[model samples]
Target: MIVVLLAFTLASFWALIAWKGMQERALAFAKAGSETQGLTHSLAQHASKSFNAVALALFGAGQYILHSDKSARASAEINDLLAQYAKNIPQVREIGVLAENGDWMFSSFETVPAVNNGDRDYFRYHRDHPEDETPRISEPLTSRVTGRPTLLMTQRLSNPDGSFGGVIFAAIDLAYFRSFYAEFEADLNRTVTLMKTNGKVLVHRRDDQVGKDMTGTALFSGRLKDAGTGLYSIVSPFDGRTKQFAYERLSDFPIVISVAVAEDTILDGWRGDRRFDLLLGAAISTILIGLAVVLALQTRKRSVMARMLRERERGYRLLAENVEDVVTRIDMDGRRLYVSPSIEKLLGWSADEIIRESAYSNIHPAHRELIKGLIGQLGAQNRTATCEYMTRRRDGNYVWVEAQLNFVQDPDEPTAEIVGAIRDISKRKAAEEQLVAANEQLKALSETDPLTGLANRRRFDRMFDAEFKRCQRSGSQLSVLFIDIDKFKSFNDTYGHSAGDDCIRQVAGALASCLKRPADLVARYGGEEFAVLLPETAAINAEVVAEAARNAVHDLAIQHHGSPDGSVTISVGVAGGKCDARNSTSSMLAAADGALYLAKEQGRNRVCVAAENPSLTLVRPAG
Candidate 1:
């Protein structure tokens, strides 16, 4: 029995501990994952900004080199200055000046012929797009002469008379960019690569990829081009690990900068955390096992005489201390004979002070007589009693308790006594009450429009169904006004979706405010449409309300850009009363829809009531 008890205790205790530990670990992992993604996004933004800054500085230096040489004597001086500038700007490799007919007049490298670069694509691209004021950064195109990976930067030049005569073209070294990017990143394994929009690898941190064709590869295939700029995770061909990669299109340039970090690099911290948790678990298990062994050995030597008595006392003490519920024993006279240690925990009173006192005195005065009657019922039938009772704490505050009592004979004495367990149910009761309130609030929110704070489509549907049946049973009136905004689609197309949402919110607010009674329901029927259920209103009164809605919307006079009419308006349609003997719900909706079409067909911005207009019968007339 002792071994069985020990096994049970160990299994239950460790199960609880392990469950909580695993929960904490799962939460830690989720938090770490969110932080890692955030960090990667921040790094991507920084890379794009760096690319823009470098491109701008290189273009400025090249422009200064091209414009300084206006005469032959100054040509030699300008060539020397251009060479110094190219060396100073680490990202710039070669600078050259080209005429309109694609003739390169000046070259940064003296050995290269000036005529060699005349007919390149850079000069032709500038000539095609003459109106673009910004500097043109060409897509990564391989140079025919150098046969090295390069990007071209061309800025148009004006002669003294402001005529477009020539352009300054620069050949930027892609390797220099890779080195500059390497200095900015701390992770050695992280790869940074530059590529053209056309899927050619211009420069990779690895030297072998300088002139490689990367078209079929997933990274350059279309993912980066389609996304334009953002982060992506892809399987790396080089190492097979999932790489968290991000890319950005350089401003005024067709090239994209990509940064890829390995998955293991981000998970490094989580791995350390798991190791620390395992060490802590091992230490705790060792301590618990040692304590269990000592307890078992002590139990064997006591021989069950004194041990039984001590255990009984310990059991009672533990029940009082560990269990949050109150335990008490009472005499036939209803006097408290004993109370557990938790009496102090629950009521702020020591056991000594409460022993021998009338237990009913602790209960609230309003509940004392009711509890006495319940106890009488328990004794008459030899059955237990369970009830909820409010008791006064020593602090004079009230708490809710659920109590169960039954008669028992005291082992110390043969006299009968009532032993009872009372649990503090205040927190549970409060939670139940809060849960009920929250459910009700959630039900309300589900039926309400979050923007206009009006009844949403769900509420409108329910109200319409109920009101339609009520009108049918009573043979009374039920009017539904379907109001649509005039030229709402054109307004959204012209201004913006945000302004369209604002317009809907404003109109719904106006419709709700104009409602005079609680029985009148105004709802956002669908996108730009609104509905009002006016029970007991005839077609004439429904027309008045529809006209009021139309005028109310017109008075708003909300400015819209796309409409040739240039002002906001609402076209309203009203159909009311149980005219047909059958009065089907479908027929009522058709009537309202027919009226709305007439309102729109009559050049919009007007109210039309189908039930009142005898000339225009319902297209699908009431059955």
Candidate 2:
């Protein structure tokens, strides 16, 4: 029975070691898959956008030629334009223009006899099917100019009456794109294939593979039939190895691009790790068996107990050293008894240094008392607590950390210790602070007028409510100045809305300049109207400030064609009352409005005052 038990233990250890090795193999495969899929998608998007831009440029050139006079005198200039583009565009071997009858009319390379292309797939498709306005991509074929393998991009040209004129085509060399594919990180077994949606190969790393029919392939029948981009695996018919494939479709065009990576390439390193773990596990099993036999023969309980304790301590230390968060144990007197080796990475301090210098003393001064209260609470009760605070690092900079603590109790011992794990949360704290500041900026923007850059009505109401409540206690006075730009509507209609906006801005600036105190506020009440707030001013003093505002506007001397005075000006109505229990902000606003109406009735561009007894009178003009 003892021998069988030992054998069972050995088998279990081997199985556990094998499982660990399998996990590493899985991770390696996933890493390869993720990297390949990511790069494949990125390059596909880049290629699609580039091709679309090229197509647009060609379309523009075709449109220009169609509208130009198709005379023999323009032929040289036209062919010269084509030759220049052929030199400028990368990967383009030549450019051609086909007549309406499918006869090649012009070539960028040399003067050649007219060659009929009526049998060509791209030319015949454009001629037969007129509704497909998109650029057609042709299968790989020998270039009619250079005799090199090439892919074609062709677009339909329309006559003046919207009839089919001809086809404008660009022969792009396959060799250029094939060389570009080599820049990617791919092994010998890997493949980059570009084909049409109909599963006709247009370009491939293997030159001979071009123009092959791949419709019945697993990639086309299973993965491409369902999604535009994804992963698929297949056993290579050539090498008999399973290969993982990532594919991306050119969304703007009917082209599918795929990349294949062999599975053996991904798992090459994992096989070595498996062999090493198996041998190590077998050796460990033998040592364990020998230790058990020796302990049994010696029959020493103290030695066995000591060995078990050492093994348990080593297990704990191994677990602690592997993690990033530091584990700590502190005494009731605020001394750190132990800290994991991770402290060196977290705070640039070794565990020994932290224990000798004291952990709590290095906390930020503002947070030290908060941490002490939390620790005291943990000791006073049997509970776990959590906190986030700043801790000073060895470089004298503070880093934010989130700590979860537990009060560890022992039945064999009288004293207790606090055990905790501390994780760096500096990034999270910074994100939180940025979120708060962004919210504040958005709030300010919502309450401000965009045109005049002054406080809007929403901000004015809140300030008025708060100031009204404060004045109810102090029994101080409050004033409201209602201002209106005289003939503003006529001004906009005469000089245009642009000039009207400038007028409003200038007037608002003049009114805001009259208020000297920070507590005072000027807000855009609405179109062509503004309001000023004076916190502790009586009616007489507010009238003086209102006259000053009137003078400031007159001094601007902005010409207004509609105004009889021939200059932009403002009319002000000042109203003041004690903000006691009897008065409200709305009541004061009504008084100011009534005064403003009376001022307009008396004359434009003058200041009027609303007294405490609700009487209106004109204030003398300021110099």
Candidate 3:
């Protein structure tokens, strides 16, 4: 019977250890997956924004080629414009326009090459499909001039009659992406990849794996097709190691960004813990079996057994005193019976000093009730309870802590005690707070214009739509002010782009200062243009605000050699009315635009108001 009981006890202990090991393994993987997913999301956003900027440059060049005179197509002005586009976008290696027959007409490069791209896949596709006006991203290929690996972003240029004219393309160096991805590879077992949805790799941590086809893999054909983002584990075909992967698809482009860490790398800590637990369990099991045998054989040697038990008790007490976490023994009434010496290191209190005080005395006033409730649960259920709360240290500073309480009852006595462990969790709490702050900062950056420091066009449109609906429901008046810097293009041509940027920033700051009300929103609408949304304001009140903004910009006195006023100035247009089924945000925008055109027409540095009718009303001019 003794042998059977000992065997059953050992089996139960090992079973519990196995269960805990499984839980720890799962938790380790979960943590790695979550971190990888977040990294993939950030990388995807960066790629999308880079591609979008390049596409915008291509579109702008296409528009210029289509509208400009044929004689000026290959002139120095066009070359300068292309070079400027390339200079502004860091991801773009070159910008050029090709003739109808694929001859290089002009380029941003310092020395124009005589390369003909008529046979290139992107050029052929645009020439073959005249109706497809969307931008095309080509597969990776070597550039004809620079001989570098490049991805071409092309938009088709058309003649006046809608026939294929040529392709205006931007060459993006693959090394740019490879360099960006290399920064994230902090671990030897971690990898980052940027690839097309069709499975052709553009850039990989392993340079030799570039251009490998992955369409046969489950990631491209199954998981990616079903969702835009996901996390999974698979054996990498390039390197036969099992990896946990997190991937995100770019919203505006056919690109996938993936972050992977080796499965062994993620589970290394778990495996170590499992080994330690197994050894500890085996040691305890062997001791138990030996004690049972001794009891069966040497029943008369009971005093020696008692002495061994007392020594074991002393060992346990020594361990409790040395651990970093504070250990305490308390009565059911929350009186501290014993306190560990580690309390002095954790909370600046000696063990003897803490034992004299009630357990709830050190807890913050707001958190005292929480600690009391957790203790109550342990007493009633005779189980463990855990809670987090703020406690006052001896220095009068509050620190965050996590406390776990376990109910202990002696079978031979009628009294019960509570064993508690208190660990300082201030660093973890601080990290959680910093994460929330970073999220808020990211949100703000997404909605703000980088150059002018005002709300971006995307944010303006969202707020405008919401304000329109709200005012429509409340029957309040809604107003809009469309403002433009007078002769901005001439200013750019006279003082250069850098000076022009400074002029815009100053004007934006002045406009922001004039609006005193909290509900007013001034946003950078586009290049050299600004818009203001005024809720619960009539057209007359809007004109007043518009005039104030105009004067504020004029007060900056930024010298513009190309302007008639000899200083920077703005033209303002005001439109306002009750929003209903008949009145829409688009109509209000159109009215404001027309009024702004009239203001520019009747001379710059003045304010104009648009009536409900098509006629424009002139307001007072700025000084």
State in Å the error of residue 165, model 1: 68
- Steric collisions counted per model: 1, 0, 0
Error of 1 at 208 (Å): 99
On the 0 to 100 scale, the lDDT of residue 288 in model 3 is: 97
- Report the lDDT tens digits of candidate 3 across residue range 277-346: 9899989998999899987787557768778767856876798998999999888888998889999998
What's model 3's lDDT at 139? 89
* Model 2 regions more than 4 Å off: 1-12, 110-113, 185-188, 237-240, 297-623
Q: Per-model C-alpha lDDT, please?
A: 0.72, 0.81, 0.88
* Cα error of candidate 3 at position 25, Å: 1.3
Candidate 3 versus truth, CA RMSD in Å, comes to 16.9
Output the better candidate (1/2) by lDDT. 2
Candidate 3 stretches greater than 4 Å from native: 1-9, 71-74, 286-622
Q: Tell me how candidate 1 scores on lDDT.
A: 0.72
Worst 10 residues of 3 by lDDT: 612-621
**In TM-score terms, which candidate is top?**
3
- The global Cα lDDT (0 to 1) of model 3 is 0.88
Segments of candidate 1 deviating more than 4 angstroms = 1-324, 329-341, 350-379, 387-400, 407-419, 425-442, 470-476, 561-566, 578-581, 614-623
Residue 26, candidate 2: C-alpha displacement in angstroms: 2.1
Instruction: Give the TM-score (vs. native) of candidate 1.
Output: 0.41
